[model samples]
Target chain A: MTDIALRGVDGLKVDYLALVRRRRLYSALLLVLFVALIAGGFDLADSRNAGGFWSGLSQIFDFPVELVREAINKGAALPGNLWRYLPAMIETINIAAVSTLLGAVLAVFLSLLSTRGLARWPRLMPLFRRVMDTMRAIPEIVIALVLIFVLGGGPVPAMIAIAFHTAGALGKLFSEVNENADLKPIEGLSSVGASWFQRMWLGVLPQVMPNYLSYALLRFEINVRASAILGFVGAGGIGAELRVAISWGTGRYDAAAAIFLLLFLTIVAIDQLSSHVRNRLVGGH
Target chain B: MTTLDAGFDLAAAKRDAERRAFRKRMLTFGIPAAVLAYLVYVAIAFDIAGLAARARMDNARILLADMVSHKVHVTRDNRFDKTTVAIEGENKGTYADDQWPAWVVREGASTVVALEAGNVVRFDPDAVRFDIPDYGVLEIVQNRTGITMTMPAGATPEWINASSSRVTVTRPEGRLTVTKTRAEVFRYFGGWELFFFTLDSPFHGKDWAQLAALAVSGERVRAGESNLAAMASDVWNNAMWRHKDVAWAIFETVLMAFLGTMGAAILAVPLAFAAAKNFAPAFPVRFGMRRVFDFLRGVDGLIWTIILSRAFGPGPLTGSLAILFTDTGTFGKLFSEALENVDRKQIDGLRSTGANVVQRNRFGVIPQLAPVIVSQVLYYLESNMRSATVIGAIVGGGIGLLLTQAIQTQKDWEEVTYYIVLTLMMVSATDMLSGWLRSKLIGGR
Candidate 1:
């Protein structure tokens, strides 16, 4: 038996090499396409009257000290200004905050409908799920545009749009959590013939609460950045200033670059804060 | 018997309390339910279709073609022979021509061959010179004044206010078509000529506000009102109304994302290989790579595009490069997790195959990851379709240029609606394409 095993007898293995052998050479060759693209982009960039890299860099920072000071001291009007963007920024966060609040309130109701345990209305679950799916699929911008016209410019339409979307997404997320929850507490309550609400309140709600809170907070962060740009349609926000600056052409790029930096920082900070909270809460549980 | 009766009675009371609490909770749930139902009702009652109709209506440029059916006589300025060219038309028409511009029209069905309306003096703003080949047929339309802009129905006054001559556009559903009136019976509003005479005010800086204000009043040229019919027509007629470019720009934007994501994948695949704990078995390497992924994903593609655009120069190149850098970080993290989940028995089998280190990875690890890596790339490509437009706006490339312009100019909300529709269409198409490609590429699990 030992001599037979030493004869290099491997098990009758499947043809593992078939995939590579039958695979189109292009599958592996796809990497070269990227190399070519990078090279091509660099060349096109190089060939354009595009100033040399040093020159482009130099031009970006060439904001004459005198010019910047002039803009700062004189204050701004419609075309060439910076000071007016503040109110819009504040309004953006306000819309984002109010929208999140509204969405969370709606999500609570949706979550109840979502739970099979509640059995709130036996026939409505499938229809309600379809409604949620459609809402989630529509982009926020599309909702904003349609609502803006009906509501007539302001943060209200934007809030409404964001709220609907958030509720849908949060509802879906919360339902999955509810479905995955431990049934021990509910079962223990039910063994005594306790009602469904009593079981859910003591069981499911508590279990899913942490994930729900974490989700809402993260959503608030996303809504804030999106709200900032709604002003392009005159909905009122910091996005108005951004639109104004961008419209002025390459001349005003630096100002926009500055705004983008702040927006980026805000998102990063929120993500870190939310993640930390979620970890702590989950760990404790 | 007496003790059992007391225990049963206590159990019955407890169960009754639980049932009562459940009933109360169910009753309270009605409040939120009513609110949701009301909102859904409101959504339907609001008439989104009518709103879309109105948005398309307002995008008109107020066709000046019929109202100013007058004529302009372009003549060389007598004061300085070489410098100023003069056009003789009605006072309102001429002045409007100067503030806006008149498309070149000939007396007959010919081109505006004999004349240039604005002067060529160094100080005065010159007209956009069009080289007409012959007096075949030149219906003078204005030079690219308000490139068709799309506004959402929700557009505010801030979005509406825009430069008279420089129209910015955006992405949405339908095209907002504005034809610079092929030069008609129009003259400069300020003077007979389009330019403020260099001979007269060569060095003097004209008060810019009065001129701009004069330009916008009186229906701002009273272009034709467009509904779906107007929009449909504009799609074919307007210079900026072409859908192919919009479609292609969207495609280019998607391509930029794919390239960027691929670039990220290339950089990431190697890093992910090392980052996976199973492969690296080193805490520091894995942690560092994980941090890089977190940081990359944390900043959105919109900001990344802008920042990279600044670091690199402008154009599609910057947008693509941004996609690459951001994708590299994200794909690295995602791919690393996928890499770590791979089967270890395959590694053992690869070793027994007398495979070298490289061959072992090819034979063992790669096969396990092929479907997953491709799936991720396909998914990110789908995501980047929308992201690319937003990013493109900051960078001044792709369809986002139209999106920025439409919203900023507030000339037409329909165009904005059109672009949004197009984006959804683009995403759906790509989603379908990618799904098919993924299934085909993987050839099943």
Candidate 2:
């Protein structure tokens, strides 16, 4: 009996060792494949690029250093430049704010329509979800450029583009939040013969409002950056101004530096503010 | 207790509750009212009323028309006395001498184009004639003394714009324009023209079944390759749509997102350890790392893209590095948060098993953090693909460059539409792919 037990234990040990060995081998192989992909991709990119990666690495700090040196030399103009660009900065912020507001409003209906168990038309939930998916899939720049062609260069194109994207993004997130909401209130409202709008407004809205706001706040932060970028492509904001200033090159480094400072500070301040509010909305409440 | 005092206290409490409810109701109305007022102010500030005047409905119409339909241009160059038929009036789409659409036929020195709705345009040697079904034939003659146009005798129709040197006739099916230098007729056709193979390709205008048969046969469409390879090369290298270049651009964009997201995640893990409260080696180190992350995050991707493009001279690498720099900060902050929230009992268990710091992290902490790390990384990877396109535009690379170029050309709206569709597909595909990978790896549904 002791000999039989010993042989069985020995066989089990061999099998366990082989399994461990195979798992390790597979992991190593995956690691090697991953490394190869990265290395190969990098090599191909470097070859196809106008400037090789290694060669470009040394020159990476040149532009920043020059900008700084020029700005410091013309430090007196910095404050004046900042003052000049303030309106443009406001325009950028306005684009973000308006888009966020419009997007959140649209998202409320879209999310409610798409959420399972709470959809006004449950049979068409997939349709609404697919529409949201397609909308979300489109890059903002594409829509912005297309609208710019029709609308001409202005804030409207950027606003519409960003809002379009924001609605889709927030709709998906808000629907997820809706899924977590307790349905008893909705059912009670339905039992009381409340209309669809009233049911959603009275029962569902209160529960999901905080999360929606938090997500919208985060989206607002992202949109601010998007608005600035859109301006670079000629949507009329600080980014457009920045593009012009930078294109002027050496002599306008002071102006560029001032704009950069403004953008950086604005982004950081908004980040801190929105993040604090979002934390309170999500966590504290 | 006295009955009167108890009743007074109950009434006061009821009054307080009613007032609070009234205040809450007022707030609900006030908030929306404030929002509406702000929107009104914004509308005025943005000059909403003036938008109508600023908008170009003609451009919108052209864009809408061009996206789903193409125009074939038949031109008679009066200067050279030569006629040409081309798709979208592009030189790359000019047909060879032997090739011409059935609707257009060359007779003697004149090229005749048959249009829908029984309209026909004839480009004779030095004069053009448009034969309308309902109206009599309109003629225009071009010579050294300039041009003259003659329409139906009764009254020139509204669709025909006639002047001494220029004549333009617009119809639902086609348009005829006669200028001193050139007389051209554009026939509208549904669908994108020369999408697969250009006029120069031997496989141009072949249907799918025929092409498939040719592919399977032992025949060679070109000197050294099978029909299949020849057809593929022709389509890929097509000068009009540039399929090969477009495919490469898309690949580069995805590659940028891949490299950036992975690189950032790799760089952030160690820094996250330093920044995390429980995992920090020292207080000042954690503080410094946190500040570094803040600086990186505050600079924003736009600034990083600009700086990197200036350095790297506009390519996928610059866009990738910009994404990497921005995401490093994001990943650092997020990963540190996740690390701080990790269950400590597992680490203690590993320590009890005589595991050191490395083993403790590898065996205990990693298992706790893997789900968050994987999910966040994958989510960002999907989002960064969209960001890469925007960054590509600024940095002069990828599909964004092609898209902007197409749009800026003002005549390539079809190409713009194609790029937009491709970008949407790319984004959706990445979203699906990342979601699938996340679920597969992290066991999240």
* Every candidate's lDDT: 0.57, 0.90
For model 2, how does the per-residue alpha-carbon lDDT over B128-224 read when each residue is reduced to its tens digit? 8889988888888987767888777887688888787788888888989887899999998989989998887888878989888899995787988
lDDT (10s digit) by residue, model 2, range A1-285: 666587797887887899999999999999999889887877876776778888789999998998999899999998999999999999999999999999989988999999988899999999999988887888899999999999999899999999999999999999999999999998999999999999999999999999999999999999999999999986978899989888833348888899999999999999999999999999986
Worst 10 residues of 2 chain A by lDDT: A244-253
Best by TM-score: 2
- Candidate 1, residues A57-113, lDDT tens digits: the string is 555434334235544554343233333444556666767776777887677667767
Q: In model 1 chain A, which range of ten residues has the least summed lDDT?
A: A8-17
Q: Model 1: per-residue lDDT, tens digit, B377-423?
A: 88777656655665666676666666666655543444565676677
